[model samples]
Target: MSDRVALVWDDAFEAYDFGPQHPLKPIRVVLTVALVRACGLDALPNVSAVIPRSATRAELETIHDPAYIDAVERISREVADPYGNYGWGIGTGDDPAFAGMHDASARVAGASITAADAVWSNTVEHAFNPAGGLHHAMADHASGFCIYNDPAIAIRWLLDHGAARVAYIDVDVHHGDGVQAAFYVDPRVLTVSLHESGHFLFPGTGFPDEVGRGGAEGTKVNVSLPPYTYDDAYRAAFERVVPPLVEAFKPDVLVTQLGCDTHATDPLAHFALTTKTYRYLARALHDLAHSTAGGKWVATGGGGYQIYAVVPRAWTIYFAELAGGSTPTELPAEWVERARAEGARELPDSFDDHGVILPRGRREEVDERAAAAAQETVARVFPYFGLR
Candidate 1:
């Protein structure tokens, strides 16, 4: 079997930028694509760059209200008043309206759909749309810096295209509420999200109790860890919850939101992860894609604000894994210099951040809480999959 991987990207993705001050910067995607080239992953024989087209109004309507789509289109034409609140979750501090908002956001959604089509058609063994994974967009409004809810849109596309089962795994520090909401009452798509507890995060949802509704009960799984959750605990929770459920679900395709914001250095959320966690996650997800989903995987990028130091490196690792390649531990000199020229201040010299240890007392407290949360999540949802 060929390990062909499609990198769904277009330079127009930079048009999705919110503003100079927004925490969600386009520089992260820019740096990630640059590092992919710098690491020579783009030059591999099995890897190919695939430029994507914009999502059409009909496609966007599959996951968004037409009124909301119209609102975004109308808002995209005018110069945004930073303080203006045009409703439909636009022009707010989180999802500020800018010119070309609809075009850029629709392009992201279209990119994820392109990845899904490629994987389903067997054109590639896997596909990664690094500019995609705006998982926080709602049918009627946007939230959490997401405008199009690309993962959900792509999942719906898969279902429409004869895929009976699709599994979505989200590891961002924020709950994948929008994706969960999209399929909460449908059994064909299983949505699993592991993130910091809603008590401490934005959108404030994704508890163990938020299982799927009606016939889809037990299909929507959430492992909400406490703040300060570390690499081991998070990975353990993922292992205990995600793999078992995915195996049981037996999805026809696997989709992932590879958000690297759980890194300790991130400015938005609280989790003590290092690049090691991302590396582990990439390897594990890659293995699962082959084992359970017949090697059909569609991956996307999401929340990671540590643009200079973390997001690029973490996502570069993911793309390498998807392409059946490995990255050298030493950071390339030219790439480091480029990041520095782009205003990077505290760059690491290698691909990995060995991470930091918390004080013993704090470590023990956080460990215990995270373990309990993971155990509780397992105990709550395991019965649904017939696992003890």
Candidate 2:
């Protein structure tokens, strides 16, 4: 297996931009690459920034409806979703019709598919597509700033290529509803999502009772963590849930959605994770990939609203861990200045985020909620996986 980790990127990826007012700003990605360069990850022998091809319509159709594809194409040309009857979740402010929307979304999916192909073909043991992981996207609709579900498409492609089993783990603050919905009844793909409880989050699904259907029971894991869940609570829940289920599933490949919005500084979401805690999560996932799937892992980027202070550092830690390099404690001063100039509201002196303080009388409720959610996942799904 090649030692290098494929880093999927292209100059046109910034075309996935929604607009300046959108919370899922493309500048976060730009700042991530900038920090990667400042830390010399792009130049690392173990990291290769591979250019990606835009996915063809056929590839996209593997996970999206043909009519939806046609709608996206039409919107790309018209620069607006004129037909509101498709019911594909277009024509909304969240998924505004932008110029080249189809091409850009396809490009993100293509990068993820290419990364999956590389890992499966043994061209690379691991790959990271920082531009991919549009997980909230349904098969036929755009939602949560995602036009197409890249992680789901990549997982489906793996199954179509004769892979017996694939395990998808999502760490986004929001539920990985799209990916879970994609493979809810398919035993070949196992999707595990750990996010802030849908009771308090957007899209408002991912309850424990919504496990996989039919033969895929216990295959779909959702850890609905409580609000204000700190690193210790989050880590405890994660360790209690993911590792055992992955071990039981014994997947041929591992795909992870590493969304950084769980950080306290993120403008969106309520998880209280620091960069130091994020490092542990990254390392654990990296190790899980090796231990569970013969070192085959495809990592994708997802929701993170803190473009300046949080995302750059969180993903820098992820990349550093994935590429077998030490994390840079402090960002370069020049890069910090440049990041601020480029609209990073608050850049960090170090990679670590300041810890979030839980207000008085909040700890018991938070811990109880966390404990219940974790127990719900373990209780509902572990027996099906034969771990109980």
RMSD of candidate 1 to the truth, in angstroms, is 1.1
lDDT of 2 by residue, 1-388 (tens): 2257988888788889888778888888888888888988788877787888888888999889998899888878875443344357876777776888898999999999999998999888888888988998987789988899999999988998878999999998999999999999998888889999888998799888889899988788889888898877888888999999898889999999999999987778888888767889888998888899999999999989887888878888888888887666677887898887986665666777666667757866787788888998999999987786
Candidate no. 1 TM-score = 0.98
Q: Distance (Å) between predicted and true CA of 91, model 1?
A: 1.0
Cα lDDT of model 1 by residue, 1-388, tens digit: 3499999999999999899999999988989999999999999999999999888898899999999999888999875595486988888899998999999999999999999999999999899999988999999998999989999999999999999999999999999999999999998999999998999998899999988889998899999998888887787778878888899989999999999999998989999998889989999998889889999999999999999999999999999999878888898888988989888998987888878677788778887888788788888878988987
**TM-score of every model?**
0.98, 0.96
